[model samples]
Target chain A: MTATAPQALATLPLADDALILSHRLGEWAGHAPVLEEEMALANIALDLLGQARALYAGLAEVLGGEDEIAFLREERAFRNCQLVEQPNGDFAHTMVRQLFFSAYQQPLYARLSPVLPLAAKAASETAYHRDHAEQWTLRLGDGTEESHARTQRAADALWRYTGELFQPVEGLDVAWQELAEEWHADIRDVFGRAGLTVPEGPSEGAWSAGAGRQGLHTEPFGRLLAEMQHLHRSHPGATW
Target chain B: MVTGSAPAGRHPREASLTQLAGSVPDPELPVITLAELGVLRRVAEPEPGHVRVELTPTYTGCPAIEAMAADIERVLREEGGAERVEVRTVLSPPWSSDDISEEGRRKLAEHGVAPPRAGARRAGPVLVGLSPTRHTHPAQAPAPEPVRCPNCGSAATELLSRFSSTACKALRRCTDCREPFDHFKEV
Candidate 1:
């Protein structure tokens, strides 16, 4: 059966989320703090890129070709959440950002697994991503005082962007409030074990910051998109 | 597991289509055929001279799948003499290393990647280092299984990293041989 518009619309944000984050993670390839981390980040980036490809291919049935949908889109036309578009600051910041996002993704995918076949497969991969983030969260949070402080700062800085994760998106079957609660509980538990406190303040409400699902993004996304689209845009219709 | 067998009165062309599609080698793991890897889920023909093949990816993001799909179409048209070919990817009941055929496992080990131990599915949340959130029921937590070294045939190996060159493999170091090898990780 042909794809419906709502199905395409429902998947666009998720596709953008994976695509943008994949590019961000790929930026750490040669520059990660350690060799193992370099491989780890690349592997995760590749996984996200794969998810984006499948989502875009599915979208192509309703939208257009995958390459055009990915590389040809204007910055204002993108649908990625601001959380994913944020610059990966430092190793601590990257890990905290990863933890927050993966924590939300794992549960979100789990809930969607039964209804969405792609989500079921992605849920398996996201479980590993969550575990990787959780493991690092513990290591950085419980290490030396300097490491703990750095991670704490990163967590606090990124916490505000997470409100967008649980905001209800059209054509998705997830219970937004339930997902937010599960994500909050999981993060709180991990933080408590690491001797770090969940940063105080509202996570989601009328004042929470985000509108990415409507194709709005933060400032850094334009620069990131430019860098990502440069080669493809320059060599239009070129193939290796 | 659609075998290349024609029913009593069925067209021989349909069976050939299944055989041709099943014979396509995985682009990434060339040693094993798609049929051996359990990725070739089904092969059928809606009408004569038109073939449709279904495949599942070993990992959600395996980059080789598009290439593999293209290869299937090429092989079917060039070798199997099909006029029309379509490759569909299905994700439900998602692939596991356990889906690897015994022959596939043997080939993988020969290629220096240790295949997953039989019947082991990755389960439960992986606890981080020094965390108090250990699994409450001891029975539910299986003891860590020893990964036999593909190079030395020794079971004395340690996991170096969960991530490797590809999503489906883990880097492991053999204690006995001092050789690092890839373990075809169970998803």
Candidate 2:
């Protein structure tokens, strides 16, 4: 709680991204294959929640209240990109989603670190996150026949949603092109080694796909929001 | 009670308060004091008897931060005789694993936990080895040298898991001694 730094409307999307992804990862609590894996996902989720809280704390002045911004807002009000809100389809699906998001987020944070304190603080954490995702992708894609097929399928299904990440937000000064290039190159390198190929669909989220940045999310996002907001909505002003 | 006799009038008090606050044991790694861990950023008597403590978290989501803050406040009030104690969290100059002092590192090793290697972390995306990555470590901090086991100082160690009992630690096992220990991850 450093004196609430005057926040930008731009911080909203970034915060929402972290918060939503955290909830999605949290859904793996008891269901992850092993105990250590369960811990890893939960730890990563905690890190995302921390990043979201830091961003939201900055926005408390403009956004009214932190809990309300998270729990009370409608689906249209949220600005997280479509990729994060997509449900954790399977183990491979979860890893690929993490890979795409963390790859984008790490470099973006590196670029933003100079002007934004949160970004600088989180850059290293995001790097670790990318590492985690990359490792999982490499293993799942190169492992057994079933593992490779499942991993490839997950990558193809999720490829379209990734385009929304590059869409620039207001007030944040960043080289969106450079960030996207870095992400694409890195993802290609990882995928190439993992025996996977880039899907042929339009990577540019045009008008029909991956429009969560404009508050137009996929079908799964609404259900996610419902589950996420239920507790706070059920008991207003609830204290943990 | 012994004032002015010290090197500086205010320094002795601040130093004493700093040591007092730093003496609070870390909730997770009780082997090291907060001072040794290097997280107690400041201890200032803003007004007479009213102490303000500035602390930072090792990791943003570290759950131990609350316990650390509470311990700091309690020790300062009960021992330092401060009328009002306020422990505030500051995130500006975020805490780093490098902040853990030499003595703290020593204590961690003594307690069978590997201390985080300073300056081992590089600044950039890690190039993890391709297909069937053996080690599976995020190449971010490829310890310049192998993480020496605290129990036996064996260079042949394996990383078991990235996240361990706590967020800041990673589990590793020593090849020689066959003892599994927690290596403090360099952030």
Every model: Cα RMSD to truth: 4.2, 4.0
Cα deviation of A43, candidate 1, in Å:
1.3
Error of 1 at A87 (Å): 0.4
DockQ of 1: 0.46
DockQ of each: 0.46, 0.39
Expressed as tens digits, the lDDT of each residue in A1-240 for candidate 1 is 112233447878888889999999999988998776788889899888888887887778777898898899898888888899999999989999899988987777777776667777887788878777887788889988998999999988888889989888788767888888888899999999877889886655666667887788888998998999998999999887
TM-score of each: 0.89, 0.91
lDDT of 2 by residue, A125-217 (tens): 888888889888988888899999999999888888888788877667777877888899999999998888877777673533677778888
Across B1-187, the per-residue lDDT of candidate 2 in tens digits comes to 1111233655677778877888898999899888788788888887878999988888777788889988988898899988899988777666778788888999999999998877634533222322221243435444455678999998787777777787788777787898889988777
List clashing residue pairs in candidate 2.
none
Prediction 1 TM-score vs. true: 0.89
Instruction: Supply the global lDDT for candidate 1.
Output: 0.80
**What is the DockQ of the complex in model 2?**
0.39
Sliding window of 10 residues with minimal summed lDDT for model 2 chain A: A1-10
Clash pairs detected, candidate 1: none
